[model samples]
Target: MNRPGLVASKPKNWSIFQQKMRNFKPQMRPFHLVIVYGILFVVSLFITLYGFITYSMGFEFKKEYNAQNGQIEFNVELQHSISEPVFLYYGLTSFHTNHRRFLASRDEKQLAGKDISEDALKDCDPRISDGIGIHEKYPCGLVAEAIFNDTFSIYSNSSLIKPSTANIYPSYETKLFRCPNDDCSSQRVNVTDPHFINWMRPQPFANFRKLEGVFVDGMPQGVYTVKINENIQGGQQSYQPSLKGSKYFVLSTRQWMGKRSLFIPIFALCISVMCIIVSIFYMCVSRYDQHLKEDYLQRHSMKIVQSSDKRQY
Candidate 1:
C-alpha cells in the first residue's frame, strides 16, 4: 500500500495463453480422426502380418500322456491349403505299454487295409472289418484299415489301457495338408508312425480363444501308403475303407472354426486405440473451452473501457 513509487507488479499474461489456446482449438479438433485411424491402421497391420507368418508355417499340435490312466491325449488342428492335399487316418490296435511283451509279440505287424466294397470286404476277417466306408465329403475323405494286436506292449504298466476293450476306444482322422512337393502329394507325417510323436510339434491352432476349447487326446501308431498324381492339384477323390472294429470315431467333414486366442491381441489393440482417442479428445476440448473463456473475457473488458472513456469525456 505504501509503494506508489515502486512499479506495480505486472499482471499475468493470461491473454497470451488465451490467444495461443484459441489458435490451437481448430487444429486440434480436426486431428481426432487422424489419431483414431492411425491407431486402427497400426493394429490391423500387425494382426494381418502375424496371421500371414503363422499360417504359412502351420500350427503346432500338443499332447500329454497321462501315466496315471495310461491314456495318451492330445489336441490337434490340421490345416492344409486347398493347394495342398493330405490324408488323415486313425485306428485302435491291441497295444500294451509293456515294452518286453510288445517286442516279443510276433503278431505286431501293421494290419492290412479293408474296403467297404464286397470284393474288398470279403478278403478280410469280417468280424474285425465291418461298417467302414469312404464318404467323399468327409473331413478326411479316405479311410485306411489298421490291425488290432492285443499282445502289443509299451514301456510301463501305466502305459496300457486296462481290460484293453473296457473303454469304447474310437479313432479319428483329419487331413492335415497335402505335400507341397509335386512328387509327394499323398505323404502325411502323422500317418507314418504307429506311435507317431511329432519330431517337431505341429504349430498351435490359430485364432484360438480358449485353452480347453481345442484340447484333444489320443495315440498314433501305424504305417501309411500314399497315392499322388504327377498332375499337381487335380482330380481329388475319396477312398472308402472298411476296418475290422466297430469302435472308432472320425470327423465327418472339413469345417471352418473361429480361431482361438485372437481375442487377446484384438482386445489389447482395441484398448490401445481407445487410449489414443481419449487423449486426443481431451486435448481438443481443453483448447476449445479455453478459447471460449478468452473470447468472453476480451469482449467484457472492452465494454468496461468504453464506459470509462465516456465518463471521462
Candidate 2:
C-alpha cells in the first residue's frame, strides 16, 4: 500500500550498483595491521608449544576394564617404567555430574552433618523419597545416589600394592560434613571417605577421572594385576545403577601442573592456526588495496596538471 501523500517513482537500475559493490575495496588500511597480527600469530604459537611441553612433562599409563557378569579382574602389563610417587585415578564415562537436576538434588545441611526435616528440601520434591522409607533417602537425590563406590586393588606379582589415602580427603571436609547416622554405619554415605569427598566436590564434565590414591613407591615397568570389585553388577553395585558405561583407571605421574589434559594444548593450537590464517588474509587485502590507491592517485595528478596548463594558455 502507498502512503496518502507519497507517489512511487520508476524503479532504478540495480545492476550498476551491484557492479560498483563488486569492484569496491577499501583504499586506506592501517599500515601496521599486518605487524599486529603477525605478533599475535607468534604469541599463540608459543603458547601451543608450551602446552604440549607441559603435557609431556610427566608420564601417563592407562588401561580399560569392563564388567563381565559383575566381575572386573584383569592383568595389565606396564610397558614403560614410571617414576615413583605415582598417582592412581579411577575413571567413569557417560556420567553427567554437571546436570542441573543432579546438582540440585542434595540437601546441604544433611550433607553437612546436620539432621534436617525433609520438608525443608523443596527443590528435591518427589526425588526426596524412593519408596525406601517415608523418612527419605538419607543422602537424597540423584547426585548422592549416583556416587561411585567401585574399589580398585592393584597387585605386582603376588604382593598387594597398597596406595596411601592419607590426606586425600580435605581435613576441613571431615569437620564440615557428616553422615546422618552417627558413626555413619547405617548411612548410605561415608562423608569422611576420601573417595566420597572427592566425588562430592563435583565435576562439571561427564567423562572424567578422580584421584583414587597415591603410591609413595611409584610403579615400575612390570606386569600388574588389577582386581576391581564391580559392585553395580558384580559385588555391590556402587556405580551407575545401570551397567552401561566404560569403566577404567589410570596410573600416572604428575608434573607441577597435575595430570595431563588435552584441553589446553589443543585450544592453543587452534588459536595459533586461526591467527596465522587471518593474518595472511588481511596481509593480502592490505597489499591489493595499496595498489588500488596508487593507481587512483596517478590518474588524478595527471588530470590536475593538464587543467592547469590549459588555463595558462
Candidate 3:
C-alpha cells in the first residue's frame, strides 16, 4: 500500500541527505581597541598646550600703597613695565614716595623756593598765597612750566632733580609745586599741564587732589619740581617731584608673554580626532563578534552530519 506522506517498501539503506549551513563565523582582529586608545592620547595633548601664553595691564608704581595690606613701598618693575596710567577718583589711598622724591632731589634745597614766572602757577599749586614766590632755604617749594622732547628727556633746563634710579622715566608728575596755602603744611603739589597725558578726559584724572580744586590746568608743559616737607621713614631723606614733558615710552600688549585663552580651531580638532578613534574601535569589535558566531555554527553542523552517518550505517 502507498502512504500519503511516506513511501512504503523503501530500499534497505536509502535515506534523504538534508544539508544545513552552520552559522557564519568571522575572524576579525582587535582593531577597535587600538583606535580607542589612540584617541584618548591626542585629547590629553591639547590640555597641555592651552596652559603655556597672559599678562595684566598697569604700570608698576615705585611708591605703591597696598589697599589690602595698608603698606607702601617702591616697586620698580611696576613703574617702568606697566602700560596703564594710575587713576584716582577720591579718598586717601597710600602712594609710594618715589614720584614725590624725584622732584625733591633736584638740589640741596627743596623746590619750594625757585624763581619760575613763566606761566600761571595758580593751576599748579592751589595753596600759593602770592602765586609766584622764591626761597633761599634748603627745601623751597617751586613749580615751573616746561615741555619735554623725545627720548623722555626734560625739555626745561630748570635745576629740578630727582633720585638717581635706574628706572627713571620722565613723567608729568615731576611738575608738582608747593601747596599755595600760607600755612605750608602740605608742602608738595603736582603741576597741572594740558599737553600732558589727559588723566581725566578718558576717566577721572586726579589721584590725590580734587578736580577744579587746584592744579587743574596750571602745570608746566615740560620739566618742573615740587618740595617735600615730611621726612622719610626714620628721617631718611626728603625727596621732591620732578617731571619732564616729552613722549614717554609705554609697554606694549604684545610684550606680555603669558598663558592666554585657547584658540577655537585647536579645540575643534581635538574633538574630531576622538570621534574617529571611537568609530574605528566599534568596527573592530563588531568584526570580532561575527567571527566567533560563524565558528560555532560550522562546528555544530559537522557534528550533526557525523552522527547521522553513524546511525545510517
Clashes of each: 35, 4, 51
Q: Could you tell me every candidate's TM-score relative to the true structure?
A: 0.24, 0.74, 0.20
Candidate 2, run of 10 with poorest lDDT:
233-242
CA lDDT of each prediction against the hidden true structure: 0.33, 0.75, 0.33
Better of 1 and 2 by lDDT: 2
lDDT tens readout by residue for model 1, 146-257 = 2211121222124432112211111321123222232233433233333221211121331111111111232232221212111111111111123221212122111122
Q: Which prediction has the highest TM-score against the true structure?
A: 2
Q: How well does candidate 3 match the true structure in TM-score terms?
A: 0.20
Alpha-carbon deviation at 250 in model 2, angstroms: 2.0
**Residue 218 Cα positional deviation in candidate 3, in Å, after optimal superposition:** 38
Off by over 4 Å in 3: 1-262
Q: Write the per-residue lDDT of candidate 3 for residues 142-191, one digit (tens) a residue.
A: 21211111111111244533222221223543444332333345443232
Please identify which of the two predictions, 2 or 3, would achieve the higher TM-score against the true structure: 2
State which candidate has the highest lDDT: 2
RMSD in order of candidates: 23.4, 11.3, 25.1
Write candidate 2's Cα lDDT for 188-281 as tens digits: 6677677777888778787898889998877788998888876672223434456465677787876544577767668878887887787788
* Residue 12 of model 1, lDDT score: 53
Q: Which of the predicted structures, 1 or 3, would earn the higher lDDT when compared with the native?
A: 3
Put the candidates in lDDT order, highest first. Answer: 2, 3, 1
